[model samples]
Target: MTSYLIKSILCSGILIVVYHLFLEREKMLWFNRFYLLSALVFSLVVPLISFEIKPENVLKPVITAVPQIMEEMQKTGVINSMIATAESNSPPDTMQLLLFVFDGICLLLLIRFLVNVSSVLRLKSRCRNVKIASAKLILVPENIVTYTFLNNIFIPEKTFENAQVRDEILAHELAHARQMHSLDVIFIELIHVFLWVNPFLFWYKKAIRLNHEFLADEAVLKEYTNVKSYQLLLLDTVLQGRQMALTSSFNYSITKKRLAMMTKIKNLNRQYIKQGAIAVLAFVLTLTFSEKIYAQIEFKSKEVAATFPEISIVRFEAVADKPAKKPDQKGKSGPGISKAEIDEFYKTIERNTTYVKNKKGRTDPMVRMEPKMEDRMYELFSQMDTDQLQMAADSGIMVFQMPIPVKKAPTPEMFENWKKPEIFGIWINEKHVPNSELNKYKYSDIAEYSLSKLYGGALKGRIYKYQLDILTNEEFDRTYDRRANDRVIITRVGWVGENRPKSFAGRRI
Candidate 1:
């Protein structure tokens, strides 16, 4: 983007100087004082309409800036709703979206080959060549060197025959090229083309032009043995200056002040660094006013946490139901949970219900820092699977540790209890499967292997087994463990149900 700014500024000077050289002065009597206006119009109307603009190319930071704006918007409204804004194009409205599109299109036009080619065509004819000049080429006009990019050189029939005059002329153009007045002219033209809206840009162009002439004049005096010789040559060129359609000349009559600057003896380096610094500073300041885009997303996840720099919770929603109840119809032996057991469940629930509700109604403290991220986390958890919600809700989490099934002569009671549905999912970790030869234990092993690792308890032999003696249906008094007098506290609950393990005659570890 900075590069484009520099490039455009450079081209502006070239175009302006070229136009002044080629076009004749306007004769509109009423607009006599509007010579500057005419020049301005030429700079504005000519290239702008002469070329074309399209969104397909050109430098567009505005498009890039959109995403950044969106990100900022989201951050600002974390706990609330998105704040919407808009823009339009009519009447030169700047914030309008369409105008932004126009801005982007304009910025992008610099890249087109057609525009550069057009610029080249406008200044088609080369200025006179110089054998004595040390530069690639020179365009010293017969009039005061106009610094304007156009035809400053007034070519007449007998111009080159005067040896002393020609040498002085060579001295002057060499001054222009050495000091790079031509390049400076191009730079000003570019600034005018793109930044024509800026009034200060016009002043800057003039200042830079004046400086160029100053530098060139100094060079001419250094090259000539006597300052008088150069001054006489400049005078001769200025008097007989015949205008050309498209060249910068030695003595452009309009820029007489610039020639006078060249004639003066001056110290160049005393302020060179200071002036260069000012130009650089101005160039840098322009960057603060730029256009580019970026976006933001709030994501919350324990799994996703490892990958991201900031783990923002986007949405969280909790499912409102419990896991499907112990499947019915299967011949299952459920522990006859008594009134004592139900009371214990309520006690567990009461222990952890201390929740803080914020203005946005988030239930977790981790979410409050970034409202949007928290809201997202809340939404996700609120809508989670029933099994997860039930697990979160349940205080008495059961941890099952399945034991290896050692094959022994199968007892009638063991076989009978193993075939029940109440004990479906239960297992130890994968490593407990034992040798492959124990494959027979894979079938019907749930009750035999599963035991409460949290509280020494087990379910086997068609009954809910614990350390307490198993009683018949009549003897079972209702309680959490079916022991009316004693209650066991349940902590973490998990069922590592491995269907792959052999179920035949299994036992708890």
Candidate 2:
């Protein structure tokens, strides 16, 4: 995941950098603009459409079978697998992660909005300190509204008094303001934020900014009378520092480019139709392959997803909550777990703390077991409905949701020494864990392991540490803000494959 994240960032960064280079050149050559815009649109649309094609409900059917299948396998000590999907993350979890990514995006957007608003407020404050020259500046009512959030233009009152050059400057900057190029610039900045890792994205920002200046220059030049004077005025103008997010200004950094753009010789004989066609083609070409970085990245992650990233043996522990449902609502346990499926979930707490009876000659009995409160709850959790899971979650009974770290994935070569082994006979020394020393077969000790094997996954060699606490509504709500780290340890981590013989028949069965 970390590698993929870094790669995605680098991909976006490259795009931004390339864009910056294009902007520095100060001319799009018609076709360039076509490609950039088209590519941006395509990149945005593909992921959304891909989601619908993949569908959100992809995991529902498999999850529906987990409990019953686990039960049967646990009961009969048989391996039950019809269609085993290799481990990636689940679709719901993936969707949640994507939402989390978007949440981060929204937070960034909000930060920008606040920063802009704060800057505007500061600007408003500066209005009182603003110095006005009564003698040197005379325009339409002393304030000509010369610039906006984008062009970042300002006249030193000395230059504004020149009536001849004034309107041209006003018109040029106005062109930028009318187009809301400042907002465009802000949007570009945000693109850089998301795609900053992509160097081309950095370039894209510069290119787009320059394009705005060019577009604005074209607008004013078409209407101004003395083109040479206007060009001279632009060339003499000092470009100011970039302003806050929402300011339009004149004298933006790309002034020389803007001046050069004005020098382009336009002739009546020049074929507009031919230029238009070439521009269109150029745009189409660019659009088809504009997003070299991000698109390439998206392709890589997809290809990698197909292979075994990790062997995720997912298991869910049932946490208790909710009142009893009608008997009809609880489906008959499919094979192995149906008998233990009776709803003594809470009362079984006493039975849970009791130790397992591994008497002489019992068939694969989990002799030593001390169940934690949470693990016991998880035993019951596998039996609950999705609605019940939600209720439990809402009612302070958290289902300790866990997925193994993606970092743990090992290569096929690494597994060369590993053997192909089927997990069987999950035993817990309930006498050793969180509860207390135990005597006879307390149902919870053996029953919980049975439940885990039946529903979650076969846990023969592994041990987890689980502990649960009964929290009030207030406690739950108070800590709800940060639940990511919270978990009830199941079985304490333990070694596996130490005692069991080559086969159950050879051991003691």
Candidate 3:
């Protein structure tokens, strides 16, 4: 919603600047009126339109690698201890509070609009009517400026005595009545009730009112013979102009512009050139506004791949073993299993297992496990390395793969103690869950998990912390089939970090 408001405001501002630059001084009164109205409608609608450019299927290979590793981890029981935790800093009720404030402001403006319309109706009812040519002349008791609302031309009761001034006022107001300029004023007032926050709308209203005056002035000059006398009559009535939004007054604020427009020569030959330029400008503005609309949509595949950079797995290392305690002379037991027993168990597993070596001579443990014997394989490994296994349980170590060498590594001090992983939160479909509810599900139920940073107003400078996104099997299979090279992106989370398969930047995940 906020993004849409911003886009609307920006689009309105650009259109208004274009009007002031090219169309303001042109004698095309109807063109200017339509242009300003079109701008208003465009501002309200353009933000809702969305356009997207589909990227080519060039990234399929890079994205398949992460899912393969995830599959291997599930089979090997590596992700059994995975845990996640996240902290929300934004107040839960802030969005509601903002909406309430906005609605209240709009309500007040709506009431003001109603009041202005009612006041005009009240004035019309109280005035005395007298017919003059094709217009209904309304003689008011108060000393107010002459103006037109609908077919009624209002004038001060005293103006009836001065025939010349009365005729001039009547002619000017008759032009307003004939042109139906009051409809434009009423339309803009209604628009103001809702979009009062946009200052460009206010400028647009002013431009509209000014163009109405130009149209009326042109109409009055075509009928009235004495030009100099009419000019003097305008100067005389300037001070008596009333500040009313609902009515088109004879003497509007822009008296100087009116006088200049009257004498300005019409250039009919240049009309086509100016019209062509306006058409070109409109096309350019449409493209500009369309770009803003398209910016709001999330990209499908290529964008996801760009977010998760390729991270090479180096090797796996067993955490350092603790020293074993000796038995007491009294034949009492010590705190832990003896070192000789642990060594013997480790030797038995090593003799039975086979490890595959890659081109870099790094060993992959998953390659040795048989398909149906996973449970028995896990039982053998668990019994052989009970101490390290217990440490993995308490520390929440999912898979302990070393990361490829990079420019910067976590400080050695970060690894001095067996640092337990800090569970932040679980994310499914980009929504955070503050508890371990996901642990009830089997690893096969989950397709894959991506480590990325969560972003929001609440999470502002804490972008380095990792968010674990768990994808359901269905979502994973569909994405993998449609765009296998595309990464499974968790919306509202930023790109994955450079350091992979380790504590995020030395801080526990």
Candidate 4:
């Protein structure tokens, strides 16, 4: 809101300067009036008009390890250091207090404006009205100066005794009345009530008043051939015209400019050039203003990422240690396996063994064995058919066959239950996902997967490993794993994809 006001003031100032340079002495009163009024309206409205144009392509930046430091700081609740510093250094509610002060000033100015308007209305009620030609002259009983409000011209009763002076003053005030210059005065006065703090508004009011005088002087001179005679009359009645806030008076201390305009010759060529320049200037300002408005209104995706940096999973691995075994107590033979028990255990293993098809579609041995142990294990399963071997593979492992079946590929879900290392951590797009959620996804649903080591800040020399799995459409198919220490996943749904480009120059590290 404050920025909008500042832009409005700047635009208005530029327009006023243009007017003074080009149209002020052009002799086109109505055009000048419309231009000034339009300038005011344009300045107020231009800041609100915004146009957003989407580029055909948007480039994405590489998420470097540097931003990982910000992610770590955020996790530790220390990323708001700048905000903490600002709060500690600055006064609380300072901006709010300033706004309150500004509002108070505007209110006071509005009251003053209303009071001045009411004073004019009161004066009009007390005056006596008499119609002369087309103007309704209001004769005030007090020994005060002359001024015109709307269609009524107010003058002192004592001034009526001098017929010649009265005629000149009436002619000047009548011009103001016929042209409806009081409306302009009231319009500026109302604007002043709200924008009283703007110094330009004060000067703008003076410019408006001076222009009104120029217009009235032009109207009066159209009838009277003697410009010099009119100048003398202006000099004489200048002291007789009282300045009023909401009315156009015969004189408002702009006598010299008015007299000078009367004698000044119009230059058509110079006027045309200036008008062209002003038009071009206005066009350029409008384009610039619209761009500013668009910048304020439009939201950038990159900025959102900057505000909340993403935390990618860099690596994932299973825990290496197995459960500890109980210590055996000293006895005659502590819990020695009996020959019958060994036979039963071997029988149990043989019953459970099965052979399953591997990735090659071959029904290999259900369990892997050393080259030397392979023949011995095969001898036990020599009579077994491919189907029987496959069934044995499906069942699990046998000791005499082999200790365990060929290792089945792990699914996304299996990784969830797999014992994770105590120091291992995982994150998906800056959010922590529990093992429960991680287990729900299938491996093939992942469009891209890799392992990487993040390095920066305290992690500069040290490497923190993680796994990055970017899903295609959150669905499942087959399972496969390929390992890369440092990799990028460009998937359609997550990571760098269609909307996010490969590289962006404007990205902040």
Find the candidate with the highest lDDT and give its number.
3
Sorted on lDDT, best first, the list reads 3, 4, 2, 1
TM-score of 4: 0.54
Selected candidate, larger lDDT, 1 vs 4: 4
Instruction: Name the runs in model 2 displaced over 4 angstroms.
Output: 1-38, 51-113, 124-147, 150-165, 193-198, 239-242, 245-253, 265-509
Candidate-wise lDDT, in order: 0.33, 0.39, 0.54, 0.52
TM-score of 1: 0.32
Q: Is candidate 1 or 2 superior in TM-score?
A: 2
lDDT of 4: 0.52
What are the RMSDs of all candidates, in order? 25.7, 21.3, 15.6, 20.3
Clashes of each: 83, 66, 8, 14
* TM-score of every prediction relative to native: 0.32, 0.37, 0.54, 0.54
Instruction: Name the 10 consecutive residues with the lowest summed lDDT in model 3.
Output: 318-327
**Global CA lDDT computed for model 3:** 0.54
The runs of at least 3 residues in candidate 4 whose Cα sits more than 4 Å from the true structure, single-residue gaps closed, are 53-92, 161-165, 240-242, 250-252, 291-509
Which whole-number lDDT from 0 to 100 does residue 354 have in model 2?
Answer: 23
* Candidate 3: stretches off by over 4 Å: 55-92, 131-135, 161-165, 291-509
